[model samples]
Every structure is written in structure tokens, then in C-alpha cells.
Target: MGIKEFMISFIFTSILLSILFIPTLLTKSFAGIRPSSFSGHPQASPFPVSFAYLISASKGDLESLKRTLCALYHPANYYLLHLDLEASHEERLSLLKFVSAHPIFSQVGNVWIVEKSNLVTYRGPTMLANTLHAMAMLLKTCKWDWFINLSASDYPLVTQDDLIHAFSSLPRDLSFIQHSSHLGWKMNKRAKPIIIDPGLYNLKKSELMWVTKHRTVPTAFKLYTGSAWMVLSRSFAEFCVVGWDNLPRTLLLYYTNFISSPEGYFQTVICNSKDFKNTTVNHDLHYIAWDSPPKQHPISLGLKDYRRLILSFAPFARKFKKDDPVLDKIDREILRRNDGQFTYGGWCSERGESNATCTGFGRHENSGVLRPGAGSRRLKALIVKLLSMRNFKRKQCR
Candidate 1:
């Protein structure tokens, strides 16, 4: 069915859920829904990390956002989904309905929506602002360890259980961001330019305008740049937003006029702080392919890139075309996710016996249940390689 029809159907479904599911959700008695144990499984791991996800989307991306939400959803995780101001109110409502109507999501009550949306300019510092806004909101609402930022074009390469399982054994303070201080050509093209984002004040969409005057690089703190996407630790996010020290606050202001601020803001802040510099893990945790002598954008992943995507051993990949068949294959094979259902995880008990089977939850429903699959092995391999003394220590903000 088309998106409109799907949404209309979902609205009715949500109404029914409010009437039907409220009782099950309110009771303290329904507790046997979680997995019994995680003794020994081929895919099991010992990681106990809880991830907080900030998923950002814009106009014409509702469908992809919904699908990505399901693919990435897990009970142990906290989710904040934002549809930027560019999207229509109807689109935002549809997304809200989908999340609220879902039985498991309503029951768990872990998902959130940013009702007051921010206007984001493409390739502007507003993207960084939006991320920080969500990060701040998440910090206030829940106590989670890692904060993963994703876009509508990105999809999970593994289940949340796998992700949580794999992360359980690792240090809590590590941040997975692809970064380098080399700057190379970007020094002239990005760092030297002073551009003003029209979205900062304009209602209509417009390209960023550059001021004729060039700006000198700040000697106050070293500038580092990297991929906009990252999996950040809660401690580091606190350091950035709360600014117990002045480093994060100072860099935020410095990057206000910086070109491609999303790529530089977090990088510079994390690297400049002596306390956080050593906590960096220099990978974006995504499998993204650039064209030879890459263009402004990474190549949109399609069926042709499937083999490489799986082999990359990364837990996420990006820039996929909407409704790409590769995504369908990922949903079916990798995530074990049906069209509108969450990815298979220990929390989903209803898939086995009854409609409410996976609905089983307890005060500690997320205690020690990780059913990591092949993707976990892949991610684990990459994590292992990254944490190895030589590669891990040598690549930090250098």
C-alpha cells in the first residue's frame, strides 16, 4: 500500500491500541515476556551497553524514517525521532502515530518525538545544532551509555540485541567517530571559507552564501574534521552539551560560522579536550563507499554494493536510495524484520507463541538478553581490529 493509505490505517490502529493495549501496559503483573536466559548461544556476547538513538529526518522521508525506526528498534534502547521543520505537519503526525500505535513501542514507552522541530539547512551548522538538541533531551529523559546519531538514509546492519551484546564487553567512555586532523584539501575549501546558512533566518530553502572575506584558523584549539555521523558516549555528550569545562562551549561558537560544521564541530571539541582525546575510536561505525576521487556525496548504495556492505564488518551503512532492494534484502535476511515489525531480538517474545508473547516485559526485562547474529560477529571483528593497540592508539585525532 502507499504511504498515505498506510498512515490512515495506522491512525485507526493507534486508536484501537489506546483502547485495547492500555490495560496490558498498565499492569505490573505481566512479566514473563522477556527471554528466559542467555546461557550459551552461537551469537551471544557479554556486552551490557544501552544505546540512545537520535534519528533525524526531513521532508519526503517519512516512509524511510518509519522503516529505519523499525529496523533499528530495541526495548533496551532509547529513541528520539525528529522530522525537521521542512516536513509538513501531516508527515510528522504520521510518524508520531506509527510510533504510538505500535503495541510494543507503546508498552515499552522508550520512544520520543521532537514536537518543536528545528529548521535544518542542508550542509549547515544547523545539523549539528539539531543533533545537540536531541542529545540534550535524551540525557535529561533517560540514563543510557551510548548515543548513536543516524539519518533516514541509513539502516542498521545488525539487530539492537547484537549491538548491545557486542558493546557489553567494551569500555563505556569510547566514542566511535571517523576523524582526522590532516584537513588536506578541506583546509582551503572548508576551513578558510566563512559561509552564512540562510536557514538560520530564512523561511524559504536557499543555498548557503559565502562572505567574501576569508577567516583565519583559530589557534585557541586545534581543528579536526570527520564524517558527520557518529556513535558518541553519554559521558562525552554530557561534556559537549553540559560543558563542565569551556572547551566544548568555545568550539561550538567557533564552528557557528564554519563550513560543514557537522563534520568539524564534534571532532574539534572531542580532540581538543585532554580528558576526551584518548576516548576516541576513529571509525564512524558505518560502511560508506565513495566514488573514485569522490564527489560531494558518497555513492547511493544499491544492489551492486551489497556484497561490500556486508563484508565491511560495520554495524551501519548509509546513503541508500529510498526503497532500494538492498534494504529489502537486509530487512529479510539480516535484520529478520517483517515489513512493519521490529528487528528480531530477545525482547520480541510474541513472534514465537502468541501475539503478546514478545510483549512480555519486566522491571528488568532488558537484564541480560542479547541474541547477536552474523552482523555481531562482523561488528565484533571490526571493533577488535579498531581496539588493537597499534590502530586504536595511533589514530586518535592525529
Candidate 2:
């Protein structure tokens, strides 16, 4: 090809690629979107509330996982960190030791490591199983107000104090889950297909196997599916894990062989149950954006998505690139955390060389120690909108 033609082609391709990818990072929150607030509440754990966190980490995620754990750490909360079996044994041991050696963790005694890890296939039922395992463990060990599921790639947009402060006013039965009843084309492609996940029985990582025959939708209940991540209430989690009702168990057995069970299992169980249906909040509380033709995986958040991410006012976002500069900005601005430091909160009382970023701790006694920042205001706005007259009951588990 001639030099002129090559240059022209290169320029056109560059422009097209830029156009395709740039807006994901550049867009701000949808225009004129202001949510109301119920912000006058006191800043205390209203009733000695505790949170159980199930944080899952996979291969090559040790550093980011550790960083995230530190940033999200709170003495009052219970944490169970699982290293996926796909990760090497050495890696798991390394993470275990890191958690064990931490002075604060040892003192608080709320952190636990999943000694026996489950094998996880990306986008498979095994991921759901792991979440259930952690839930069961938490139910057996301690009392908590809610169960929060997070991944190593995901980070908090607000401090734990801010989270606790906001949630203190909420009714204990509410579950934060983003869901939709519209199956669209997925009904034919995903719902009817029968696929066996090898991770259930095999030691090796492999793709889910599909059967030739398709099955009909269940007559017993409606199928609702949405984002896999959620913040489940403790009572509802117990209803799922150790319920007097048998449907949760029955559905568990049914979903054991289902593909992408994480997306559908909880939704199906909650929507099917008359007792829990009214308790659903129907918001995933995550800030995620997909491509024009949304793919099986959402796009990785990058530097450009900052404006929209902040404006969305969601407390958490997912699928960030490792060591992305956007994370640094979030740490500095939103979380008020320095690199490799804990996010600033009322519990962090000691001043470090730079600033008091959870350098030391003591039991925070004052009920009025809340110091909510701009992020808290943003999140409060979102919470109000989700709970407002227009949205509260209208869009739940439909």
C-alpha cells in the first residue's frame, strides 16, 4: 500500500476506536437528576448493627484484594475473605497470613479466612455456591444486620461509617438488589437452556456444557434476574440459608446445575416467596456500564468514567482495571484514603505521619461521631430516589 493510503487508514481506524471507547469514561450523571435526602438522622449504629462481608478473590488478585480489604475494613463488621481455588495454594496461604498478621484484625477478631476454597468458573454457578457457603458460615458464627457481597475488583465509594450512618435509618428487612423481570431474548438463550458447570464436580477450570434438549420455564414461580452482586438483609439471608421454609433449599438444588445461577437464584427465591417479596429494594447499588451491544462481561471502568461514576452517587462500582488511576482518584477524593491506607472514618482515631487514616483505633462510643462527606450526600440522594414514591414499590421484583 502507498504511504498516503496507510496514513489515511490508520487515522480513520484511530478515530473510530476513540469514538467507540471514549464516552464510557467521559459522560457525567444523567442531566438534571437530583434525589431527595433523609439526612438528619444521628450517626450511630442505631441498634448495634453489624455487617457480614463476603469478599471473593481470585488468581493474581492478591494485591488488589489486600488493598481493598484494608480500605473496607471495619472493627464492627464481620469479614470472610475467600481465595478461589483457581488461585494457587501459595497465594491463598499468603493472603491468610496477611490477614492473620494484621494487628487490628487480630484484636477485632471479626475476620475469618475460608480455609477450604471452592473452585469457581467465571460466570458459572460455582460463584453462587461460594456466596451461599459464606452466608451459611456467617449465619453460624455471628449475628449481623446485613450481608454484603463484594469482589476484589470492586471498591467502596463511601466510608463504612457513611454506609452505616445511612443504613441506620432504614428498616432491617430491606434487601438492596437490582433486578428486572424483562427477560427479553435471554429467555430463549439462557432460561430454557440446560448447562452443566464442570466446576461443580471437576478440579479443572472448564466451560459449562450444554445439553441438546431445552426445558420449559418453571410453572411454580416467576423468574427474575439481575446483577449478581447484592446487599442482603440478615433476616432474609437466614431465610435463604436456614429457613423454616423449604423453597430456598428446593431452589438451591434446582439451581445447582443452572448456568449463571448468581444472576437468577436469589431473584427467583425472593420473588417466589410471598413473605420476602415485599422486603425487596430492587437496586444493585453498583455503577456499571456496558457496551452498545452489551456483552457477557461489562466494560472495565477506566479514567474516563470518573465523571459519571461520581455523579451516579452509587456507593460502589465494579470491574475496574487493576491499578487504574481512577481508583487512586477515588481513594483520594471520595473515600478520603491514601494509597495503602484505610478510608478515613469515625472509628479511625489516631493520626499517622501524613494524617489520621485509621492508624490506630479504639471503640468509638459517641453516637454523634458521624462525619459524612460529599460521597455520603451523593449516596443519600440516590437512596432517597430509590425509596421515593415514584420508585420505591413500583419497580420491585417486577
Candidate 3:
């Protein structure tokens, strides 16, 4: 939908929602929800904020995917898991079955798997297309304030309660995107090179093919590049998915031939738009550490980075080993999640008291329950610093 159409729709919905549930919308409470608030069912009383997560994984990543999903899962939130076409059919079926067999997932029915897998090349436009495809699906499916795209290798440092509580006081329009207009060396290598991903046309997976000819960077719209991970607002997600104006579509076409499109597509789109240029907080909300000199790809995080990780106070960290001991340490210390159980939250904390794991949620419905912890305090402090006057304005679209 276009911006005008979206505004009209949003106004109409808000009017009705405001009339029906004025108290809920006007709340600025970080004090977790209570059972006494709801009459009979808590489902009718939605959380203050929710996120839509797209977890993308490829071959040999089912276990990692499961662990990450469990850590990131929340009853109030929606999750869409995409397994690349490179994985076997049996593997995809296994993932679907795992989700279906899970007690919390089956009961809450908030998790979904992308049955129609797409061939995604590492740095090709297919990766960008896959992300957009998932975004379009989520935009049509559920209601969420923010859209976060993460890979299976990425893990959350804080509980979902911490994230939701920390963001409760902020404006919904703010998007956490690390971006800058300066391309530096990328101007010649990434922006000028032409590439064709065989994943687009071929049924099977293949490498990204390079073209001998190079084209000049377009003067119509300036290029921006940064971290591929982003915390996108629903408004921005809709604009990119629907192409309300020509900027999104024009950038899509331009970046089709560009290398590492994911790092630039959303950056270029958000910065070039007049409506969204100033609505950005210059951070990717991730604690990603690189090698001293930095290689072609980031180095995998291990136990050695634990102290620095906590100091960063970012909600998520990435490029971890599948079964890294650091993950276990983070689970025990930060997330409070057990080996195979979902993350510790008020939603299921009271349910599985016998084993003390968040296993079953159908017996006791506490989807509205949100108990923030010390991690919440850390996250809030970090966000406050990022949105401080000195950091917010100076780093935006620079």
C-alpha cells in the first residue's frame, strides 16, 4: 500500500482501537503486566509492544536454528523460519516437524516455517530478495511494532521481555539501522561491479556470476552501506515491501547488480526517502566483533569475548559457533534459558515449576506477562545512550 493509503488505514484502525482500548494504548508502564488486569483471558489484552523475527537458515543449521528460536521465542511475538533451498527436503520436513511437535510452539501457534524455500546466494541479490519475501509474508500475516532479520548463527543476549520492556517508552517509528553515505573503497568494488545470481533463474543452487562490464554509480540516488542486520519499523517495512514510491523500487533495480545487496538495499532506501530520513537511530543493535585487521568475514565469537559482550549491552550478537561454550555461558548467565527449553519469561515461568523450564504454556496463559531482569536495565541504558542528543542526531545518515 502507498503512504497515503497506509496513513488512512492506520488512522481508522487507531480510532477504533482507541475507543475500545484507550487504557492499553496510553500506558507507559515498564512494570510488567499483571494477571489481575484481564477479566477472563489474557489473549484479549495484548502486550505493550511486540516484534516479528525472520530467522533465516541454510543446510546443517537445524540444531542451531532450534536453539536460537527457543532463545528468541516469545508468545506475544511472531517468528518465520526460512530454510534455504540448499537443504534437503528431509531437513525442511524435520524443521517443520520440530516446530509442530514443540509444546509451546504448537499451543501458541506463533511459529511458522517457509515451505517454499528459495535458493539464496551468500552476497547475491537472492539474499536480499529472500529477506524481502519474508518481510512481505510477515506484513500480511501478523501485527508487530518492529521487524528484525537474523540468521541462525546469531543469538540474543537478552530475553525478549528485556527487549520489549526496554523499547516500551520509545517511539515506534525509530528504526535501528547503522548507515553512512560514505562508500570509501566499496565505490569501485561493490557499487560498480555487475552480478547475476543463478539462484534467481536456475532451479538448483549455483554461484554468483560476475560480469566483465562495469557501470557507473547512479547520480539519481546516493549509496549508503553498513551492517546487514536491522531493527526495521513496520512503516519502513511496508514501504520497502510495497514500494509506495519509486525510491524503493528504483533502489531495488539498482542494487540487483550490486554486490552484498543486503548491506545496502535498506540503507539506501531509508536514507533516500524524505519521510524516513530523520527517523533513524544509528545502531544495528548488535554486538559484532571483528578480527584485529578484519578479514573478508567476521570472526566467530567465543568465550573470550564474554566480558566485552556484556559491556556492549546489545540485544543480539552474531557469528557464533554452532555449539559454542560461550552460548552455554550466555544461556546460563544472561538469558536464563535451560538447555532445551524456551527462554525464561513470566509467560511460562509459573507453568513448568516441577522441572523449572518453560515447556508448556497452554495450561496457564500468561502471554501478557513480562518480567524484565537486569539485562533489561542494561539494554535500556544502552538504548538511552544511543538515542542521546549527542549520538542520535550526529550519526544519522552521515
Candidate 4:
């Protein structure tokens, strides 16, 4: 095609996507009930809260990313996937194609991709920036009770229906963020160091730069650190994205030079903001097992962890190897998902022999269709423990 024709076609596609994709992200929350009224035990209510997910992936992770998205899919939730700039164009294109062409995704219209990939550096501000970008996009486009951030290495231990059911009774204002005021060793190492992530500016990827001069810890606000993964309320997500109070933006600039900014940025912001500090529940809601004497990263989960994985009853687990046998085990036992099939939910009629696997073929039409499994009971137990008076009130901003 000629340049003029291609330009016109691109403009038409952009307009079409703006109409089709943006509004589709506005998922129905709590099956049409207000979030404030969603509190307390509502098991028979049949109304489940909605979640907005930002799932990130890096180079050579197309398969893992696809699997994670497939396992986490539910018609009630809105998903935004990102393949970082480091991935080859062909890989990104392949992922876009997968999302666009998936029968269920096309029908549900709940999945999206960050077509303009950002360059992210490990332990740098760019990683946090990438997450913030996703939050802004989701906040503007969707109305969800909670926001969840995960990576391709992470997979769900519970199906989406189980997650929705478990979280349905919980207060929508709560943010399940794992945080601690006691920085311990991080105070000197992470707080004092001045590191520069080239990914923030340069188009090409490079190693992080460490400045020679060290700085003193600020007295303006105390530094808190914790796990990068979190489940945030829409209110908290909006507070961070909007920065109306200026605290989130101030910390954004302060964390630009800090090591592993993602681990500390939201923690610092939420703890310092008194309005939301009381809403904190010090659990990331993920099952992550670190190595003995512990390294920087957690140990990859395997078949051996299956027993503990079930016992933990957390909604998600992390750092699994690509195409691991244990993932298949989780798919079969916990998620009830078959190879190449979407996770089962009540919204869809099952297909194949004995109707074992769910084929997510249609939309919910605003009211959710949830089929809670054993995983729902397991997760509800964990949620009870986390929200218990002894566990819930004592850990805030600490």
C-alpha cells in the first residue's frame, strides 16, 4: 500500500481500538453492587469483586506469559499484559496476535496489551515506572475493586472464580501489601546508594550505574520496604496515580535513584499517607519461598513444593521455570485447567471428554458467573487469618 493509504488505515485502526478496547476495560464490579456494600460474609450473595491485573514479561517469555494469562483469565477481570522492550519485535507481535485471536478473549473483550513497550531494568526505578504506567492506564480505563500486579514467572494457585469468591467478603478499601518499617540491612545499602537506570531514558538497555557519593536518609518520611507484588484497592491505586496529595509524586522523584524502587515506592507512599495507612494488611497474598540463607531471588517452585503450595492456600505462587511440570500439576489439581485450555469457571459450559475442561466462550453480560472450588475455601481461610483482629490491626505501616 502507498504511504497515504497506510497512514489513513493506521488512523482508522487507532480510532477503532479507542472505541472497542477502552470501554471494554470498564469491567463490572461486584456483580453491580457498590463496593462499600460488599463487606462481610456474602457467600450466598453471588456477587464477586472485580480485579484489574497488570502482568509483565521480559525477553523469551512469550510461552510463560501466555500460560500465566490463560490461567488467570476470567470474564469478570480486566487484564493488561506487557512484554518489555527487550523482547524481539516478532515475540511482541506474536503475543499481540495471541491475545487478539484467542476465541475467549475476543468474545470477552477483557484482555489488552501495552503495545508501546517500556525498557525496564531490574532493581531500578524503571521497573516501578513501568508498573505506574500500567496503573495509570488501568485507572483511567477500568472500574475494579482491586489492582494486582504480577510477572510472567508467576502463576495462580487458585482459579479466578475462587479468587473472586474469596475476596468478595473482604472490605474493598483494604490493600494487601507486605510491608515493614524495620529496614534492617536495607537502610544503609538501599537507602544510601545512588543508582541510575538507563532504561528510563535511553532506548537501548544497559547496566545500572552507581554514583560514588552517598546520601543521608531523609527525615521527611520514614523508609519502608517490602515485597514488590501487591493487591491494591482502586482508591489507593487512584491516590498513587493521581498524586493529588503530592506524596506519591514526591516519592516518585525520591525513588528515582533508589535500589529496587518497586519494593519500596508504594510501601513508602502508602505508609506515609495517613488516609490509607490504616487500610494496610501486611500480606502480599503470594506464596514465595526463598532459599536457605536466602539469595536475592526466591527459589523456583517445583513438584516438591506442591504440598506446601496447597497448604499455604495463597492465591498465587511465583518464580516457576517456563513450562515446568509443577505448573501442569497446579493446572490439573488446583486450577482445573487442561493443556491449552482456559481455566474453568461457572460462566462457561465445559467441553471435551466428561466435560472436564472449561471453554470460556461467552461474556457475563455484567453479572458474574462464578464456580468456586476447593481453592475458594482454602483462600477464604487465609483471608480470615490475614484479616483477623490479631493479624490485621497490628501490622499497619509497621
1-398 per-residue lDDT for model 1 (tens digits): 34465345434423422232122222321111222123112123233667889889999999999889888877667788888889997997788777777677666667778877778888877787778777776766666889999999999998887898789889999999989999999999999986666665566668886666677878888989999999999899988867579777666656666788999989999898999999999999999989888778998998898899889988999998899999989987888777777787766643242221223343334445566778888889999999999899999889
- lDDT for position 225 in model 2: 86
Model 1 clash pairs? 33-360, 47-168, 47-169, 48-168, 349-357, 349-358, 350-357, 350-358
Q: 266-319, model 2: which lDDT tens digit per residue?
A: 998998899998888889989988998888988899889989898888888888
- The C-alpha stretches of model 2 lying farther than 4 A from their native spots are 1-48, 350-356, 362-368
TM-score of 4: 0.86
Among all windows of ten consecutive residues in candidate 3, which has the lowest summed lDDT?
A: 26-35
User: Relative to the true structure, how large is the alpha-carbon lDDT of every model?
Assistant: 0.77, 0.74, 0.80, 0.80
Instruction: Report the Cα lDDT for residue 363, model 3.
Output: 40
What are the per-residue Cα lDDT tens digits for candidate 3 across 1-398? 34465345434423332231122322221111211223223236467888889999999999999999999988778788888989888888888778777765666667788767778888887788778777776776667889999999999999998998999899999999999899988899899977766676677877777766677888898899999999999999988876558687667767776789999989999998999989999899999988776656888999999999999989999989899999999998888888998787777766444333676553446457677888899999999999999999899888
Better of 1 and 3 by TM-score: 3
Count of clashing pairs, candidate 1: 8
Q: Candidate 4 clashing pairs?
A: 181-398
Residue-level error in angstroms, candidate 4, position 213: 1.2
Error of 2 at 324 (Å): 0.9
